[model samples]
Target: MKIEGKNVFITGAAQGLGEGISEALLERGARVCIADINTEKGEQTVKRFQEKYGQEKAIFLKVDVTKADEFESVFKDAVSRFGQIDIMMNNAGIMDESRWELMISLNVMTLVRGTNLAIEHMDKLKGGKGGLIVNTASVAGFGPGFWFPVYGGTKHAVIGFTTSWAVRTHDTNIIKLFILYQFQCSKHQTLIEMQYKFCTGI
Candidate 1:
């Protein structure tokens, strides 16, 4: 596995897509730290992962993605354990509430916070050389489907932010910048292994 020894951090990782990714990466021999708002589900997810991937390979942290302080602490915790966050998956997002507030936080602010939080720790990960961010940009971001306007808008924000993040990486005195898009939900091991190979070219 390309990321076999690398450290990984994932947000919204208590269940669903986040859980899948964490399991996949851990199975490949990457140490992972899961950040989730749902502490109960997060612990449960960790239990399930350890059952299969082994206890030493994975961990979890309580993180409210909307809060920058919590996001900052996750970086510290991940770094303390693995000395870096070589790969970070910003996969937390939602569309549950009413339009205005939901769209504002879910679509725009969440992605923005994830990006900012990752950037805050990128220097330590690569010895100031920059790193990889696999930001999830939905197919919805590229198209506006009926009844999905708000979700689509936030997805578009993710896309735009991804591009901007790449272009600006150099400004921080870092190089070898990388950002990728995930359009759909595929199985965990398959997609994670593929991504590790493609990103690291191993």
Candidate 2:
């Protein structure tokens, strides 16, 4: 899809990979809504973007992705601000083994919620323009992670969930779903590699 003039709603965009994605989108002339739990960093990121890309190019909304209400509200607010959302990037995730349940909630459940909202707002059959939903998974989803078993499990769940929706929506052709896998070489790995797959169906 063409990136210019597209409106993107992205989570965990305050820093890291999400921040990079937001910057790339803006550089390509897309308007981005940078949603994150970290208000301070999020504001700073948006400020920087606005200064570089112009004031209307980006906006920041503080959001807790694990909460259904807050997550849904971000979508509503993004649509209100941008007029319509053309891309939804579910990039917020954590790898906390101590708090495994929260990990599952943030990494898996919240992503599901975000994808659903994207479909609801962008499906052409529902009187809205069709768009793309990009879910962030990890290389851990492909195999065992002895040091971070729970984190790996959450990523695995993400892959399964996104692919399932991809198949479900194939016939309609109203929305496109994609899986983005992040890979790190080792514990001391500073560089991150990203791989994406376009889901056609099962």
Candidate 3:
């Protein structure tokens, strides 16, 4: 489908791959909602996009995906600002060292909360063609993760969610689900499938 004219809400859009994806979508003339905890950085990114492409390119939102209220409010605000939501990427997440609670909140709870909010908008599609949801995961979920056991389990959960929900959502034609694993963010981040682990001796 054509990305132009589609309303896509992206989380964790302050930097990294999320920012890159937002830039690409803006270039394609998509209405993008750049959401993240780093409000200043997020707004700055939007400013740069607008300066390059004119004023109506993107909007920035300070969203903490772990908070149910924030999740709900972000989607609601986005819908209120822009007619409807077409695409969603549950990309706002964090990394912690072997902390089970931190891992669950960051990797799993964020996706749960964000998807719940996003699905509310997605299911309201007319003609069964609103949009899709994409999730980010890691290779460690499947393979043997040496240190981050909770992180691995969380990704396994993400995989399960994507596999089970993709075909069952309301808008079959509108809904497309994508999952990515083991994308190297930087040298410090380890790819479980790769042998060279960044063993920081933490």
Candidate 1 residue-wise lDDT, 80-134, digit = tens: 8877777777777776536567556755787677677667777655454345567
The predicted structure with the larger lDDT, 1 or 3, is 3
Models 1 onward score TM values of: 0.80, 0.89, 0.83
Which model, 2 or 3, shows the larger lDDT? 2
Name the TM-score of candidate 1. Answer: 0.80
- CA lDDT of each candidate? 0.70, 0.81, 0.71
Off by over 4 Å in 1: 97-100, 124-129, 170-202
Question: What would the per-residue lDDT of candidate 3 be over residues 115-190, giving only the tens digit for each residue?
Answer: 7666666665533345777777766667766676666778888878877777677444446454454545552242
In candidate 3, residue 26 scores what lDDT? 70
Candidate 3 positional error at 175, Å: 2.1
- CA RMSD of each candidate after superposition: 3.9, 3.6, 6.7
| Local lDDT at 159 for model 2 | 83
Give the candidate order by descending TM-score. Answer: 2, 3, 1
Candidate rank order under lDDT: 2, 3, 1
Per-candidate count of clashing residue pairs (backbone under 3 Å):
0, 0, 0
After superposition, the stretches of candidate 2 with alpha carbons farther than 4 Å from their true spots are: 171-202
